[model samples]
Target chain A: MRVEVRLFGGLEKFVKDVRFGEGFPVDLPEGGRVAELLDRLGIPPSQVFSVLINGRHASLADVLREGDRVALFPPLGGG
Target chain B: MGKIVRVDMTARKVTVEEVPEKYRLLGGRALTSQVVHDEVPPTCHPLGPHNKLVIAPGLLSGTPAPSSGRLSVGGKSPLTGGIKEANAGGISSQKLANLGIRAVVVEGRPQDGGWYLLRLSPEGAELLPADDLAGKGTYEVTKICRERFGDKVGVITIGPAGEMMLSAAGVTNNDPEGNSSRYAGRGGLGAVMGSKRLKAIVVDSPSLFNAPLKEPERFKAAAKRFADILHQHPVTGQGLPAYGTNVLMNIINEAGTLPTRNFRFGRFDKAAEVSGEKLAEVAVARGGLATHACHPGCVMRCSNVYPLPDGRVCAPIEYETAWAFGPNLEIGDLDVIGELNYLCNDLGLDTIETGVTLGVLMEAGVIPFGDGEAAIRLLKEVYQGTPMGRIVGSGAAAAGRIFGVTRVPVVKGQGLPAYDPRACKGNGVTYATSPMGADHTAGYAVTANILKVGGYVDPLKPEGQVELSRNLQIATAFIDSTGLCLFVAFAVLDNPEGLPTILEMINAQYGTSLTVEDAMEMGKRVLKAEREFNLWAGFTRADDRLPEFFTYEPLPPHNTVFDVPGEELDRVFDF
Candidate 1:
């Protein structure tokens, strides 16, 4: 199955499909968890700062359904 | 009479001008902003002689007001090329006010290559050649300047980074203990000071110079009430004084707003290792102070002096610093965080900017995440003037350029502090829309009660957050103009009558009848002025955005992307 993935801040360089695209629009294994998706995307679990699935909170272990959206964010410090 | 001190480097002359009639009503950030806007040409090169560096004490400085010791430094920013003000706690603001010096303007550059240190006192001002102070870090400069001037003097010194002129170099001010650590750290104002060939600014004013209260009894009574309110509040009076703002590390992490490992999640498994409570425990064991004040004449003492194992002191590891260097980099050790704080301070670099930039560098594979030692090693390179160091100190955006990473997290060229937008969308809006170039303190109106504005909306709720951010930003501008430390907002927010009391005190002091609405108007006016300056300085709406990463990537725990639509965001400054 396919699930859309989005990356923010410093992580967007690796997305080859678009120079600046929202939602990575990639193929993901059916019922993949965040951990599996991260491994597939070559993003070390440690490098990813925050994650959101369709505007809500999700754990790394949560299974992603087909057509579900995932977003990746960098750490925040605007002080 | 409050006087404006002017130091012209080219002539090596110092002059004192009486506070101009037009600026008498302004203080702190308001004063600095007005002075810069009135005097400095909008298109002047920030590092050129055309730019002027203005430092002013808030209206309440030296007035025994609660948390009113903020000193605002403003100039054309080398980082963003916009109007910039960086305020911080230190002895300088109060000393300047006590000396009846409303503001100090450093103008022009010296024709000679020699640097100078400008010293001020009740008697007069002096310009001393500081050739020996060149290339010296802030710590040595502070200690050496203090020894030459006397222990009683308050000092402001720049570090090696300022000399090299990394755009984020901050002006280091001595705390009560004379550590050259407390800083007016933002927007590369220090670079401007450095460009003026000023290595240090030493102030040693007698108490005879203190500003006289127009209504002494009213001032005393209002001050008493203000102190009483702060003493009665928990977050400011107790929690902050006891645990310091670092306490927020745990709470924010719990709320899933703490930016961890470059904002990958709302939570960090090792958050306890670098929390305020944890730091408090460590400070107690190491004979370090956890709840010390950052400046003189402050009731809400929220700063600290963290001691490393070598008995060296690393001052006040603020929450944003901890999150930026600790959790965001995956380095949970307080010792490392404290050391980084010291490094940033002595190097005259902005800690939050450097830390966030380092996280971006780590994302670029130049340094591995959670490598505290490697980060430290890289920091040394940055301090020593390597191309890599220059890139890092120039800020995350510059670092992105050198490393070929386009996904830099910056607003108007200034790096964001340590609050993840995915976790706290309210703060995210603030990050996107603040006129001060991604600054958190730009909208620190935690006191919804005093604003007489909207009631409490859960920080997590998206509705009304834009308005909340806007109101808070305006209110913050007003408070900053008062030249008071913003930590007072936490205390004032808890007390239903706290903000009114502040306005009352100002009203009583200024001999005017300014109401809360008028104050709000001033806040809006200041914001508008700053926005106009930024626009004139070439910042567009595209610059008024979060990194695209925030939109496409969802944060962990409370996984939320940047849901605030772009059109809605563009409507932020519509008023």
Candidate 2:
């Protein structure tokens, strides 16, 4: 299965060529969890604060389906 | 002894009086609100002679405390028709504090309508004829004041928008770089200043950290601990320094609470194009700073220098302003956003109110959506004092009424900010019930609702929202009084020692053994005073509501409407 992943708030530092919020497709097992996607991107789960699957909050154990849009962020805030 | 300088604009006389004993513990919003409630008649027209403008520095403003240089400007809001305390970051707060001034109260308008400037220094406070400075933009007014009164002096001034008594006009003060973009940019306090025929105030003080401290050594130690706490937080130490407040663009967009295109959608397709990442990239590429401080002793430095392509600079384009001009208008270009931000700063207008007004105009078919050039042209009309410009400056609610657009996103006549309350229910409760009327900083529930800073609360759920907003609003009222930047809450919320460390600094400075409970009580007192003032001004439970559309309009992605019950909103100030 293939899923689109985006990084933000300096989480993009884990991937060499990806800019913040730039999405890239990644191949994953049929029922891969968010933790598995983070492992594939070489980003430590500790560095990621919030994960959103298709614009809703998701956890590391949540299963991802094909064509899912995943966004990962570091601990960030502003008003 | 701290002094309160009262300037009678009607008589053109200035009198310096001792601070009242009751107001000794109060500072910033606490002091400003108390002064406004006591002096200004509740039912008087906000722009009339009865309204008095109170300017104050926070309790720790001129002390060695880090990021404690906030200034509070208070008045009866011309827009909201309620008591207001608009806060800003600039050098004037520290200057005023160091000069031993607790607050400056401007009362009674000049019958002759002659312009004047209040010059303050250690020698004395005096009103000077400012006819030469009339009709100038804030940037020019600040520059001229800086040149006349040493470059080190801090200048607080307004532009033609204020002079024209626009409801959206805001009071602005200069940063260290002399950029007059540090605005108390809400509730239309600038119009109150303009109505008094006061053009500017130049605070001339040589000392920056000479405010009397009761326990100097203990205060210094506590201040150090607070600074370290800020530096240790990733949000303040790293993310903010790298990209400023605009960093929230992507996360908020991904969270589906960005409020795109006048709240028609929850997310903007090109949000990243104007995100903090893009802002940093373009700012650095154009010989501008990606990180800067708005005032001295600011360790977080979550401000930037964005130099536009037109050779002008908008010193710090904050998250709310960017969202207002960019995603709110469906305009993705950062340069266009920068231009609009600069125009607001120069015109002394509230950027959020102007953007929301422009959105209402677009909905009325006065201008096309996503037309950045047209938006810029329309904003420039405020300088010309045209009818269209007056309508624009009257804010979103007025524009909506004039154009017959019922989808206006406002509470208490002030416009809603970047976050859509439909998705962020905790903030929704705040927008509805806060005395300040739709002000995000009044009680930023985004900490729990979206950012997961203090604790995690489901953003889309109505459960636990009222309690979340209530607690935050109380804590925020206290913090706003300390002259500390609200961003400090990011660190304070996560760390157990944060609130105590802050109290320790305050206790050491004031020689008062105030506990966490006393601080909480103080916060409650501030809110109660504000709420009581609002009630006296004829605002009832009906006025404490989000616009009707927010209840029915389900925002996209999460597909959530603001479902927080009105009865629960009434509970926000039950304390």
Candidate 3:
């Protein structure tokens, strides 16, 4: 299955050949969990604080489907 | 340890009195709110002589505690027509605290319409004629004050917009570097000050951090631990210092919550061009700074200095200001945004109110969307007090009324800050129910809703949002009283030891055995006081609502509307 993954707030440093706010395709197994995708992208669970699927908050245990738009971020805050 | 300096503008008399026993323990927002609630009538016209402006430092101000120099300015808000406490970061709070001042209450309007400056030192405070400093920008007023009084003296002043008694005006004070960009820039507190006919305040204190401590060793240890905790937090220690608040530009844009072009969309196509990374890159290239501090003793320096093309600098262009002027107005050019920010800083106007007003004008077709030059030209007219400028400076709500635009984004007559509540529902809940109308900082649920700090509450969901905003509002009210910058919440939310250390420092300083529960009660009491005042001032549950458009209009790209039920919002203050 193909999914789009985006990284923000300098979390792109953890991924190979990725830039902030840019989404790239990632191939994952059918019914893949967010944890597996993080594992595939070499992102430690502790390093990432937020995961969003199609603009809604998602957790690591959430199952991913093909063409899912996933975004990951380090802990970030501002007014 | 505490004295209230009462300055009667009508009588032209300055009197120093011992802080009454009932009000002795309050500080910062708590103190200012108490003063306003006790002395000023709730139904009084906000700019009338009956309205008093109260300025106070927090309980832990003028101490060695890191980032504990925030000042709170409170009064009847000309904009909201209710109780308002606007917070800011600058050197003046600590200076006033060091001088043993609990609060400065400006009472009675001047019968003579002449401007006066209040000069304070260890000896005392006195009102002096400021006619020579009239009609000047805040920067120039601050500069002349600093030059006349020693350079180290803290200068607090308003600008021509305030002088005109515009409801969008804000009170500004100089940072350590003498930039008058540190402002209590909400609720039109500057208009309250302007109505008092007070032009500027020069705080000449030799002692910057002589706040008396009961247990110096214990307080020192606790303060050190708190500073360490702040440093350990990645958001406060690293992400903020690297790019400042504008770092959220890309993150919020990606979350599809960045309100673009007057809330018509959820994302701006030119977001990256005005992002923090771009800001840092350009700022560093132009001999500017990407990170600085708004006040002394701040460890988490998230402020920035962006030098413009005209060789002038706009210190600390915050995220809310950036969003209000950039994406919301469809003006993505950083230089133009900086120029607008600089103009607001000099003119004593609230940037959020001003930007949101400009967005309304664009929505009305008064100016074309994305026209940066037109926006700049319109903003410049504010200084001249032109009729058009007054409309723009009257804030978002008034601008909407005059233009016959129903899409006006405001609550309780105050302009909403950067976050679009429809997409970011937690912040939306906060905007609706907070005692201070439409203020994001009142309960900044963005930490959980979008930034993924504290914890994750789905930004688009209605569930768990009430609880999130409730807890944040309580915690925030308490933090505002401690003279600590609200940004410290990034560390406090993540670290279990954060609150305890802060309490230990406060307890050691004042010799009060206050537990976390007691401190929380202080927060609740502050809210109760504010709510009571607002209720008396005629704010109902209907007034405590987002604009009708937020629920009716669906924002893209998620196509979500603010769905948080009003009954759930009422439960926010159930405690």
Candidate 4:
């Protein structure tokens, strides 16, 4: 049930001064879509370019589990 | 013609040499590697007096060529103990070229205890005592250098980290706005400069000298067509201009190869947090530069700026740094990452290496994973010379040792960039085989259909990865040596005539009729020469490998280890 939320790149402003997303490894309230987690992080769905959970691409409805390292990256534009 | 500027630190002497006869065929990486191999002793200690640091502009530098302002800094890497070349974009290359200087060589060691700056103008070269600028960060040094040398002179300087000779130290270069934001940020080249006891190098823009152009009309015609190809390409023109390389964050994550949590996973769970769309949106809202060029005349303009809280300027955070610092270590704060980007600029370090190493430390629980504040403190507030900061700054291999973590992914002494080889097989070949260590740019072959290689293939394909990596690496070497931007490869490869156009431009500039195939051959030779230097430096096949962890611990999502056969990976020289 626990999901530790981490954000990166240009997305840190949403979490106040917390540069690294450390909302604690905790249990999720229930099953929800990726959109719901975005809401939790104050991110709009429109702003999300890519979403993956535990090294796999995730849909909003991808179920969360305990101790999942939920990592997020800002949009990538690499040379 | 541009000449080589040589400075004898030991004797306080300076001289300029004409471009050598054999080197007439080379530029960029090719020129740098060839020069280093022939001039420097293979067994020379990278940090000792025998190791000379040479900075060379690409073949196309000093011309009105698109994305051709890149300069290569080459020497034996203090970190890798091999021939190393870290390239960057700034005003230095073109300015140096304009001044009729082909390359600048800093040799021997300075006996003077005080730090000094090298000033090169159309008049000549001189070493100035810069005791006042010692220990200053790059930004402050640039401001002072600009005031003293006038704003037109290009500058390359180090930060406090470089002064301390940290292994991660990067050489900072001034951006178009005169900020010391862009860097040749890899392989600890700054430490080489630091070893010479030099603080900075100031270049006065030269107005008169032009490298002889063989056939000006043909070059112009070809350049126009090449620029057109770039404009027409989707990835190069549209995606890059709109989102920059950060756009790959989402796409690569979608493919499950973003390399999160210190190589523990191939993808991040919350990738959307820093996806390019999100970055683009925030950049729009916060007055951040949406997309810009790192160098002038760069039509691709993949580089962009990220603003501070009040929309004030901060260094534009690149995707490699973002992924390494963002998801790999489990941190998702963009501003913190941006601040770290700025700090790395000031500290004169590579963001990707720093981030990757920090991820290793985080995995070891040196500090809690995803704690951006802790990461910040460890880098900026805490002395990097301290045990903890040194562990992080020494790069991933060293940090992995300190943390007792075995999942370190590095080749040679350099840390891998953001791509996860478990998912992207061709890039895996690149990571494994590149002479430049674990560098993504060594051979960045995206989907064949994506216009980079002028065809499309499934990203998951295992069939053509070897050839793909081989061809791409050859092409990249050619591009890098020409001092041309690699992003231009996207556009050139897409159109059938793109490569020819590039060749046409080069031949036209040099007044030679060298064919495109010959250029490709030059590319191969550059890699071979660099590899030969590495071999001479006492590296072996065992050094050309991913760590044991990548081979054993199957990464998540795909549950795939680096599946590239060791034999096939080793045969990357099969061209």
The TM-score obtained by chain A of candidate 1 when compared with the true chain A:
0.81
Cα lDDT for residue A63, candidate 1: 91
Please state the error at residue B466 of candidate 2 in Å: 0.2
Query: Residue by residue across B1-575, what tens digits does model 2's lDDT show?
Result: 59999999989999999999999999999999999988989999998889999999999999999999999999999999999999999999999999999999999999886899999999999999999999999999999999999999999999999999999999999999999999999989999999999999999999999899999999999999999999999888777887899989998898899998789999998999999889999999999988899999999899999999977988999999999999999999999999999999999999999999999998888999999999999999999999999998889999999999999999999999989998888898988999999999999999898888898889899999999999999999999999999999999999999999999999999999999999999999999999989999999999999998888888998889999888888888887
Report the number of the highest-DockQ candidate: 2
Between candidates 2 and 3, the one scoring higher on lDDT is: 2
Residue B476 miss distance in model 3 (angstroms): 1.1
Report the lDDT tens digits of candidate 3 across residue range B1-575: 68999999999999999989888678999999988888899999999999999999999999999999999999999999999999999899999999889899999988886999999998899999999988999999999999999999999889999999999999999998999999999999999999999999999999887899999999999999999999999899887887889988877887889989999999888887888878887899999998898888899889899999989999978889999999999988999999999999999999999999999999999999999999999999998999999998899999999999999999898888888898788989889999889999999999988877788888888999999999999999999999999999999998989898889999999898898898899999999999999999999889878999999899999898999998888889998
The Cα error of candidate 1 at residue B319, in Å, is 0.6
Q: What is the TM-score of chain B alone in each candidate?
A: 0.96, 0.99, 0.99, 0.96
* DockQ score, prediction 4: 0.16
Best by TM-score: 2
Worst window of 10 by summed lDDT in candidate 3 chain B: B269-278
Residue B341 alpha-carbon offset, candidate 3, angstroms: 0.4
How large is the C-alpha RMSD of every model relative to the true structure?
10.1, 0.9, 1.9, 6.5
lDDT per residue for candidate 1 within B1-575, as digits (tens), equals 58999998889999999998988878888888888878888888999999999999988887877778888999889988889999888888888888888999999999999999998987789899899999988988899988988887889888988898789899989887888877889889889998999999898976622467777779878888989987876555655676677766654665567787777777787876787767767887899987788776777677777898889898888888998899989997989888888889889998988898998899899999999998988998866799888877888888887888766778888887877766566667888888778888887422231112134544555666688788778878888988778877766655777888888788777787888888888888778878877777777888778889988888777667877777777887777
Off by over 4 Å in 2: none
- Candidate 4 segments whose C-alpha is farther than 4 A from its true place: A1-77, B206-212, B310-312, B381-384, B447-453, B456-461
Per-candidate DockQ vs. reference: 0.04, 0.77, 0.51, 0.16
Instruction: Tell me the lDDT of model 4 at A36.
Output: 68
